[model samples]
Target: MSVGTTQTRQGLGSRLAALSRIVELGPGRVDPKLLTESGQLLLRAGDRLKLSADHTVVALAGGTGSGKSTLFNSISGLELSPTGVRRPTTARAHACVWGLDGAGPLLDWLQIQWRHRFARASALDKGESRLHGLILLDLPDHDSIRALTDTEADRLIQVADLVVWVLDPQKYADASTHRRYVTELAGHEAVTIFVLNQADRLSPEELAECVADLNDLLRREGVEDPVIVTTSATTGEGVDELKTVLADTVARRRAAVQRLEADLDRLTLRLAKAMPDSGAPVPLSSIDDARRIGLTDALCDAVGVPAVGEAMENVYGVRSVEWVGWPYSRWAAKLRPDPLNSLRLGDLRDEIKGLTGGSVSAQAAEVDTAVRALSDGLTVGMHEAWQNGIRDAARSRSAELPQLLSDELSEVAPRLDRVPGWWRLLLVWQYLLVLLFLAGVAWLGTALAYGVFGAGSLPAGLAVFGEAASLPWVGLMVLSVLGLGLLTAVASRNFVMLGAGNERDRLEREMRRRVGTVASAMVIEPVERELARYNEFYSALRGVRG
Candidate 1:
């Protein structure tokens, strides 16, 4: 064999190994039958190639009465293959070897009966050493009446290193079912031979027309550089040309490798059709964002975030009132509930243990709809597989979703757990203001008591921390203090309500972010991993064909 051809086969062997490994890693990604068939073919061909490096196994295949047996006998110069018009003449295969040194192991593998095989040197001239190491097989008629004959022909055809299809002048230009085999072998042009057998029956002009017509059929099948030769075994005409062609092929010693390579190409192409046409996929719009929003919305509903926000607003207002409102109203403020305490977010696991929260169906359905939309860009089968993969990814941790969400909420509760220090300052200031009012009222009561005992009429001259005691000034001081305290209470209520709004908005943003993380880690990552594996398999298919 030429060094280049040997190198090509070695490269192909490496490609096959890589493809086998990828198939092992990615089971069910393609059809199981296809995988098994390709793998078995690879192992079988590898074993055959290793058994004998020099022997070229060429199959003489043809339909009924195509004169292939006569041609086979003519080539071997012996009556080894049965020939006649008794319908199915050859039910099994007959092998002829030019040299006897190593043909036994190969013929044994081919399962040719010992009596059927012959040594070419014993029958043909001894000068035919140029065709040494040639394993020529005369296979049963592919269109034989006996089912076993046809089955044997098919089995031999698959294992043979090269195939020479023998055609007669009569059927050369006519349409026949056997022609389909030649057409399907377009990729095997390097290892295929088309012989116009029984050429002695036709005139020179008729021969030209038949060969031209057959050439056209080959061209249509994409068999560029097709090998077409004419021979007549009965008249000993053009038989040497066939022998010379076989000699040249055997001398080169590359037919077996070429045949193996062609088979790999055909199988690789068949398997490649299952993958995506393009390697670089236009990314499907990510549902990660939408999914995050959906999940966060669900979890927030379960945790009652909106309800908590409202409570927070009320708690803020209540605390504000306690800090700066009327003394009696402060006690009323103590009766209201604190929003944070009701949420049970602090040590939330034990607090909300029995909470049977769940995800909403509408949200999950929307996610499913978006995922199916991605399939519009893919073929039907690939789309189905992708959809199934996505469902598997999502359901990986489906049972833990609620608990995960609740735990995540607890982890984030600290963000909202706070009380402003300004409320304390307001409380202290409120106390001072109330004390001023009480002091004024007490001083007025003392002066009024004196007036009731005939000293109260002189109340305007009463000294009360000033040069003169005046009811108007004292009453104004008390009223102003009360009004300032009411305004402070109002301001505190608005401030606390504003804080509650800000807290809700902030928590929503963080919650959505957390939801996105969970979805990606548990779902999106797995789906992308599967996609990456498929891409690798596609690349491997290209390598195997190359």
Candidate 2:
């Protein structure tokens, strides 16, 4: 169900579920102190909700000498409660159980002694028999001399399923009673009753004035739709009316549910106001795009990808020198380090890697800065608080991020070992040309020795290079060797340059993919989880409101 809708026809099971959920939520997302002891109240109400209370436990509570006991006696039709001029009489609570046999458990729970409990079957009076399940209580005076008497009365008020506040005509508008109890119980007006107990003490006009004043006082105290009945314990003027109210309430047997429902409603109001509005549904951008550009750029800086790319270009140049340099100079080129190897990247034979060794850890600030850059775009439409929170959540795993990037980059970065097949073919052809050049040099030298000093004998059929002829044949062979070798070097340099550009593109794309993966894992998921929790909190609060 949506959070804004109220369930008017909510059943018992729904109430139980709602009440249980409030307790389950407890003080986690919200502060418990702001709850005004609601957690404790909810627990107590939940326990009460489980009981099968057939009787509507109504308490007659009032101040000193208000004739509350007299009213209780008139309702019970017996002198069960002590009444006198004695100030603040009655210590503990006295319960009157009507037409109920197993009220023992409930009375015990109310802390009323079995000795103070009395039962009336109501069969003696046919007209008043409808008050059968009424467990009317003559509570100790709330303004009692003994502090414990007032404490007992206050405790009983909370536990009683229904309450009838008895007051005298003179003290009906008492400030203490209005401020202390009545106002606090404004939420429970559904299960509350108010009575001017000593109504016969005043004339009709004065009594009417008192009732009107009491009603105004109650309204001021925030109690809406109050039921104010004028009662006379001695003259019995409004005693029957009060009895009828109890009879109507007891017949319905809904006072307990109403009381608990009011408790839940009151508590929910106190807790729900602290939450921020969810507002309209705005589209939230995914973290992927931000990560691809922002995080990847940071990683490129920290991982030295540009430096690596430059070294790769230089390594191709180094290979060129080795391929085309004079024989002695070619050996000297082999002695120098391949510029790519100077990067200190750990063995990347298996995976296409971006960062290796401690390269990522060296410039860790880049990774940290990525959060700010990425979050600037990711949380564009979010509130300031939420944007900061999301940014914090995304950067929360910055400590482990470098190592994670290193591992993931290894899988995505272009492999350095990938040499184009054409480059290898060119290298083989160069080696064979060098061999041909040496063979040509040997053939020319042998002919020169035979023609000049006869240092050795030469077979007359052998020709230098291909077929020895006039027309600078020997010079042509010499030129062929040197010129073709230089051309080969030029071709090799162009081929590697093209390969380097392709490699750079592949590496950049791979780095971006890995960066997005890491950012989602470390950043986006946590914030989204918090969002999910907020929604649940909102749902539970709504469930409780219902």
Instruction: State which candidate has the highest lDDT.
Output: 1
TM-score of 2: 0.77
lDDT of 1 by residue, 1-546 (tens): 668868977886777776676566446566787788777777777778777778889999898888999999998888888888786787888899988887788889888999888898877566388889899999888876785434778888888888999988777654553465776677898899999998888999998999998888788877887899999989889889988999888888888777877877777777766654453452343444554455445545555555444444444454455554666577764666642344445554333332213221113433344333433332234535544654565555555655665566555543222446887787888788889889878655655555333353434554453323455677788788888877877776777778767876776567556655765665556555655555566567667766
Show model 1 residue runs off by greater than 4 Å: 17-37, 100-105, 121-127, 148-150, 268-276, 279-407, 410-440, 451-513
Q: Count the backbone clashes (under 3 Å) in each candidate.
A: 2, 0
Error of 2 at 19 (Å): 4.8
Superposed Cα deviation of residue 368, candidate 2 (Å): 4.7
Residue 208 of model 1, lDDT score:
90
Considering summed lDDT, which 10 consecutive residues are worst modelled in model 2?
A: 349-358
Query: What value of lDDT does candidate 2 attain over all alpha carbons?
Result: 0.69
In angstroms, the error of model 2 at 416 is 6.7
Tens digits of lDDT, candidate 2, 26-100:
444455574436656766666665554576789998988788998888888888888787776677778888876
